[model samples]
Target: GNRAEQKEDLRQLVGLTAGSDDKALLADITLRRASMYLATADYEQAVKQAQQATALVATHDNKTLEARAYRIWGRAQWQQGRANAAKPLLQRALRLATAAKDVLEQAQNYYDLGQIAFLNNQFSEAQQLLHQAIDLFKVEDDKRNMIRCLDNLGSIAILSESNFEAALTYFQDSFRMCQSIHWPYGETYVLYHLGNCYFEIGDFAQSQETLGKTLTLTRLLGDRAAEANALDTLGLAYQFDGQLEQARAKFEEALAIHDSLNDRRGKAYVQTHLGILLSNLEEIEQAGIYLYDALSARSDSGAKETTIDTEAALAWLDMARGDSDFAQERAQEIAAWLQENGTAGVELPFQVFWQCYTVLKLTGAAEEAQSLLQLAYTQLMARTQKIQDEDLRAHYLESVVYHRQIIEAFEATTR
Candidate 1:
């Protein structure tokens, strides 16, 4: 039977047992139905079934089943972006699983907690928790959970650490395992991350190709969120490739999806990207509008990285408008904030530094411009050295040369 049919069958089974005296059987059926609902993204129905199961098993001896119900309910909440509401439910599930000596459920609980940590940008804690879950899943020979842990670890490396080389290794391993197991879901997720990694390393062609595959799979799976995410990344790939029109289209499409889903975080991210693209296209007024909106949305969502990026784009916009003094001040403020927060290793600050130098040079502050240029050069060199891939390293070197030429030209003009 198809998934919908199977879900209906489970629901019917639950209904048939509604008048029976077997509370355990009723609860078990409800839990299974809840899981089916969760898998299909029917989170409200999933929560309803899980709550019913939870009430049924509250005073019962079926700790394992109760744990399963709680876990499913927590997953539903987490999927809805209610991480705070989900955590205590997951913790309760973990306690029940531990009391019942259910290693599988315990592993699942660890994975859930690890996902929460990852979302909160607690990379080290996420790694530790995911590793523990991986060890337990290995012991149980649970290939699916193992693949999930590997995928999450790859994401942590990419998003949290910007360690693209290590992230690629993890994704490749996970992709191979998914292929071996015929798990298209996991394969699609790996492809998405692989595309993101490729984009980060300046491989626009490969990134676009991989993200295309991800888009196809997400559409086939009817996963709107994943489809939107793929579109956003594809837009980034196009933006980096200088396909501005295509990039704008993709961003608009993703924004529409995010709006339909009421996903404020997704909307903020797309807005930020669109703003950057508009800035690059010299649409200063529109760029500023988008950037300011994105800045507000990102601040509300607590997306620190994107908020910083939006600020940098706004400063760049100021520079484009010949407001060198204000641009330099804004860029320096952002640079100081990044440094004070110990977030100076990322590419955003480097970009901001370059803008600051440009502003200083334009305003005839040659000495200050030279100082900023030297600082940017040092940071770029350090970052380039950490890039293990030869092609990516060459890309960074190219950027360094371009920046050096600009500095040289500025110096000559000042002389």
Candidate 2:
């Protein structure tokens, strides 16, 4: 509801009831209003209402309601990407809920904490916490919360573990449950994750198909953030499918939305992707511009993975422009960083390694080229096996074949 409608309703409720005497009821209503504000993405109003609720409930010795208020406040912070700030509030909620023996609130706190852990890239901790929430939700017969848990678990599987098959199974189960419950919103989330899993597994066709549904549903729901994310993933699907023009259009559209929203992280991510796509298309000058811009954005955002990815693209662009010495130096720096920081099982690092192989091969650094080619070939082969679709598998295998051809050519020339 709008603020005016909510205020009018609250006024009527207070007038009809005994006003200050109904402290518990007022606190409950305030918490509900806070949740409504949170749902509308009004974090400031949500936090304000939740604080009011907390004050009201504190006077009445209502620990459960106070815990609920804290949870709402923490959730608002989490939605604003302040995971660190949200954690202590959620933990306090959990502590209070545990003291009150409020099983459902405890479960909710666990789920929120799991989300924080996932955002922090602590996948094992997230999995453990989510499993706890799922178990508690199942015990309480909370089907909706269980579905959310399953969806998040699927995300952890994909983003953390890189287990696309397992992630797909989780998403499929969650999707079926959402359908059974007639929850279109839940279904949309499940489909979005399914699309991402398909993309990760190299099934671009299915990825595009699923993301198309997600985009349609997000549009229907009028969720700009969801729409932007769907478009971003759809762009990746198109890019992987070799549809460069379609990919560029999708990326541009997503970028425009992110820009309008002032979502710096989203803009940085999309910019990195666009830089990579332009590099692959051999638009060297434009690619260099985008790559450098993306690098700056990622660095500002402290997005380490994306920063490395943009740097890799820029280095590759240097090589494409016949600056082999500069490219080699950049590639060596990136290789050292990857070794020290680890790749986090992401495909970008492997793509960087492939570029490194190309640079070394062309620069007549046979020993370095052979070593990097072997590493890239192994990683590519492993990734190819994850693509269950035969055509997609073959498409992905072409990279491995190219790597082999380069290696063979090198051996022949050297011999």
Candidate 3:
């Protein structure tokens, strides 16, 4: 039985010989190191390890090892917020797994690919991939993976505009599955997401209750990453409810954790959230500082490598300062990139568009704001697939709802 220390040493030894002649051994070692780095939120390092593993597969003609490498590499790339990069890698992994007659590997590939597509706003593609993975998991009698796919599918439905009731159904189904399996991780994760959905549909009480449950579970599990996420969402819930002080406390606590972990992505999230919170409180100076930090990070890291939240935060701050010239410039840049990446209807990034609309409304650019807001509505309304997980669907809904409200307010201001 290998203890933690032994595991650590074994991992380091594998890393040292990862470039050696033993292709199979190198692939396994590289994957292991990638996992270790991912667990610690060292996304770049994980990508490096995954790439090394990928290289070994081609060099040695190790098809089996190559499949695993592609899968791990895709996951690592996704963690770096590069869903576009991850998509094709996951596709290749799926292809390799199918060719090798590895059902489990195929299921994992579909599951990951589905998630990447969902994040990139390709709901139709996400649903298809998730369904395939779900079917495979069912045949393998792997309830865990089935529940995961259900959760993801449910989220996609909630984010998409069409068929809210259907999306809710999926969320319920996913929640029930997690409950039946006694999967604490899924239970908490789902609840956190569900809370967001409830928030989106104006079900503040339910959102608060579910989000609270998620926070409790994540704390019990000692999962700092999930805890931070729960806190951020919970804070947003409180903010929506006019509990500004409580929201601030939650955001601050989340920020502390992200900083301590040195998670750049998490830090970027916290900074963006903090900027938004301060802006809402009318603390213009402090908000400017936080927003600048977020934008600086986003610009330095590359847009694809940073969360949309950071870009949105900076854009909002720019608007708040009446820097319409710069804000519009950024919006144009984002809109072009989103279109180039095949995101339609809402060609502007959701959060950033709302910010841009807000500025336009405030500046009495009613016609322009209305045009953009209509696009958002049209994009959101065209989504019709049902997501089959309660918690995750809820989170997706919540995000949509929050942005929706921003658009609504923009429209109202014009009247």
Candidate 4:
């Protein structure tokens, strides 16, 4: 059943069992309700229900059920942006699953932990954990979760900055697996990933086409959140391709949907995109409003990483307005913040590094800009080295705009 129907069914089940003496049945029903809440994006309610289920199961000897309760609770916590709290709960759940010899549950804990690791920017750890989950899922022939593993593996591959080719391979592998399993949800999501991949690889036409297909599938599945996500992404494709009006329309549409759902995070993302578009169009003051709103929204959501991304966009606007001092100050502050926080190996896809480098250079901070350029080139080459195919590697180095920019900046500055 769809997420909405599943939620309603689980709610009815809870009501039906309200006076039951069977603690186990009630606990199970409540846990299912928690899972439904999660599926419907009611993170707080999911956490509360999962906690209730855990308490109800505590007096029983059902280790598996207790583990499921913990797992659901952990997932709800992660969705609620409490990943630190989610980690230990997931670990406890994993231990229980292992003790109970429940392979699937163990695999699930690993997958969730991997996701948390990814969110925490521990890319290597995330990769290793996801690999473990994939192996266990293979043992159970769980094609559905196997697709998820592949999708996350793709994300891990690309999150290092470049390696879009590697990500593309994994996403395509997942798309094929989804097709084989007739999993519409996975298929739709993977297509959305592919559309994003195409956009990042400089295939705007293909990006638009793929995302258009994603939009159709999302609508057919009645997944409004996913539809809004697609619209935002498609809007990005248009914005980056210089179709400003179309991009604005798409962003406005996505923002309206997000507002209706009270999805602050989603709205922040679209706002950032619109702000960038507006800045590009030289709507300086109004662009600043959108960008600052996005920054505040993301910061309030505890999305530190993407908040830095919005900060970078704000720097872009500062640059556009010839406010070199302000741009330089933001760049330096953020650069220092990343260093202080020990957030390594994360070149935010928002071009934060490039933006910082440009502002520093323009503002006569040559030493700092040169240092950043050298580091960026080093990272770019590191990503380039991973592409084993000569043609693809050459294309990435030569054709990808940012890659080329870093290389040129390095050469111009150093020589």
On lDDT, the leading prediction is 4
Off by over 4 Å in 4: 1-18, 260-265, 297-306, 335-350, 388-415
Candidate with better lDDT, 1 vs 2: 1
List of clashing residue pairs for candidate 4: none
Name model 2 segments beyond 4 Å from true: 1-30, 40-60, 279-297, 300-303, 320-326, 345-347, 359-369, 382-415
Q: Write the per-residue lDDT of candidate 2 for residues 44-145, one digit (tens) a residue.
A: 788899999888888677789989999999998876667788999999999999999999999999999999888777889999999999989988999888
Tell me model 1's lDDT, rounded to 2 decimals: 0.78
lDDT of each: 0.78, 0.77, 0.71, 0.81
Report the C-alpha lDDT of model 1 over 24-106, residue by residue, as the tens digit: 88889888888877766567788999999999998789999999999999988777656667889999999999999999999
TM-score, cand. 1 vs. native: 0.82
Look at candidate 2 and tell me the lDDT of residue 331.
74
In terms of lDDT, the poorest run of 10 residues in model 2 is: 395-404
Using all chains and alpha carbons, the TM-scores for the candidates as numbered come to 0.82, 0.81, 0.73, 0.85
Q: Candidate 3 regions off by >4 Å?
A: 1-62, 260-269, 296-358, 366-415
**Could you give candidate 4's per-residue lDDT for residues 54-106 as a string of tens digits?**
89989988889889999999987776556788999999999999999999999
Query: How should the candidates be ordered by lDDT, best one leading?
Result: 4, 1, 2, 3
Residue 85 in candidate 4 has what lDDT? 88
